[model samples]
Target chain A: MGQEHILKSHDNELARLTDEIVRMGEIAIEQLREAMVALQRRDATSAESVIARDVDIDELERVVSEDVVQLALHGPMARDLREILAALRIASAIERVGDYAANVAKRSVALGFTPPPPQARGLGPLAEIAIEMLEQVLQAYRDRDADVAAAVRARDAELDALYTALFRELLTYMAEDPRMISSSIHLLFVAKNIERIGDHATNIAENIWYVVHGEAPRQERTKLDRTSGG
Target chain B: MGQEHILKSHDNELARLTDEIVRMGEIAIEQLREAMVALQRRDATSAESVIARDVDIDELERVVSEDVVQLALHGPMARDLREILAALRIASAIERVGDYAANVAKRSVALGFTPPPPQARGLGPLAEIAIEMLEQVLQAYRDRDADVAAAVRARDAELDALYTALFRELLTYMAEDPRMISSSIHLLFVAKNIERIGDHATNIAENIWYVVHGEAPRQERTKLDRTSGG
Candidate 1:
């Protein structure tokens, strides 16, 4: 192929790779949403379906990684190389998000067989914020917008606050009614899963920042103050 | 410089890179061990020290990454290229292990002020398994031994079992005494942090397999039977 044709093909391949990553991100979002819905409804079937879908996301991660390795063979320029590297990292983060979703789904399935506890209700809004963060970060990734990515990073603290609140709320329930301990523990774990999903979304945003700026963000992503129980 | 001299320098750089990764793994292991010790002793200072040491691990990751990128600048053959790519991933995993260690230490500080609960003692063995797994996986990476990596993967189930047992034990404690709930919750999170560290070691093992076999493991690393509570 002529050098011009080769360059054009390479560019097209990168674009296709980007498209694949976006698709993977969408599937990840779907997994999170489905897991939330499964928990809200206590639908074991839906939860199992969410669990199964994780394999697909895993396959997509492998595909993205192989494509990255193939692209690396071409010896792309530094900026392009950074994009490729970031894509690989983002794909892994997306896969972990999928795993967290699956873990949430597993808890839902277990919680499904039993009567739903009242504390399970808190998960709805928590999942909402996490899903929103994932959506914003994926969009930032597609547009290569570091501003949007930074905003997503800032928003994670909201999820963390919700998680801490839910943690305390569940503990109170378990304390007041020892009968509630088992189910409350499951709900706590589910909330943790959703909160970690937010963290993974933040991780994706960070990767996007790296892809765009060729470095980490200046401000450290704020961590939740868990110790003070504030 | 002659091509032979250039090749020799490349080999040396790769060796240096491997040495760096091994050192990173050692820091990761130390972090896990120290976090465990801090948890056992309820030493806030040591916990804070573990938190501080994470910066070193993060710096190591950045150094290894920059080296990988620089090494990539020279178009490497496929085997050498895979090694370089795996080194980047392995460093990231090591860094994540450090993060997990720091997280355990964070929870330790929170749990410190309270009277030491009986459940906190369970962490001793859990941390041991995790540290051993990390040590084995790092050795596998150094030797490129897929067999050793696979062995490490199997041993993770022991950690998972211990974690599950601890989960049940702590739940019982909280149920029996409402006053214990808060501390129990922190202990549960500490267990989880260590469990996740095991998972990260498995991740490192998987990377070793990828480096050697140029593909994923034949069987998926069996997830802990969290669903069945086995």
Candidate 2:
């Protein structure tokens, strides 16, 4: 085999890996959005579908790991190595998104028959915001636009503020409406999990920015609060 | 350098990695157990101390990663290489345990001045069991004992059983006494987070067994409930 032939095949491999991860990311984002819709409408069928499809996302994640190992052993040319490593990491984030999607679906079913609590109202806006962020973050990631990715991460502060207010308000609701407490607490957890998914999405955006620009984003972004009771 | 120097240094590096991860895991277990005590006693200072120490665990995690990359690049001798990778994965789990310790402390403060909830009785036993599992699982990991690790994971089923019964009792208490709602929910999240720490410990034990045997352990004694919300 001549040098140019080997080089051409390696470039083709890079293009394939990049395309595959983007496809996987799109599926994850779509499932996350759909999972919320299922919850809002009490659509168990759609929720079940999301749960079933998560295994496919898991399989895709496994394949990406295999590809990375193969690339390392076969030895990517200098220009292609960075792209492969970046895609591998992004695939992991996408896989996590799929897990969260499955989680949301599970919660939707568990709480579906329970009467809606006041805290459920808070989750509506939070979900809307996270879905929007997931959409833009995926686009920014696919474009490798560090500037746009950074902007998406900055948007997380809004979710944090919303979650904080909701936490306090829910605490008050639990105190006032004892009958509604169990369902309300479940809603609190579901909303918190969705917010965490947003955090994970922001983490991926930062990782993409880092992959493009050679440094992780700042440490000052709304980190996990140390006092849950406070 | 002679083959002997190369081999000796490789062995020393592997030992260092293992020792560092073991220390990290032990510290995290201490932090977790202490945070639970702080919560039970309503001792905010102890909780604050646990939160303050989390940064050290975070720093040690970074050092562990760098060591893995160095060993990979420098070509650690064959036996040492496998041990280093196993230690690397275990170190990641240990760092997460540290995060959960901080989480427990934060929940302690969030719980505030409310009289302890009735459902919290379950947490006492769960804590005792988790403390035992943490010690046993870490021992299994360090000693590379598959049987001990398998038994440790088997105990997670009991944790789950305790959690389910605790959650139901908490719900019942809230239904009967609306005033206890907020504190009950706080304890619920704390209980859930501690159970998750047990899950991570089980993961480390499984990895240790894999490192020794070159294959996944046979199916665990039992799996977490897929039907119920975790």
The C-alpha interface RMSD of every prediction is 2.9, 4.3
Best by DockQ: 1
Off by over 4 Å in 1: A225-230, B1-3, B227-230
Residue pairs in steric clash, candidate 2?
A228-B106, A229-B109, A229-B110, A230-B110
CAPRI docking class of candidate 1: acceptable
Candidate 2, residues A74-122: lDDT per residue as tens digits? 5445433345445655776788788888888887887778755546777
Top model by TM-score, which number?
A: 1
Shift of residue B127 alpha carbon in model 2, Å: 2.8
True-structure RMSD, every candidate: 1.9, 3.7
Error of 1 at A101 (Å): 0.4
Residue-pair clashes per candidate, as listed? 0, 4
Q: Which candidate is the best by lDDT?
A: 1
C-alpha lDDT (0 to 100) for residue A95 of candidate 2: 83
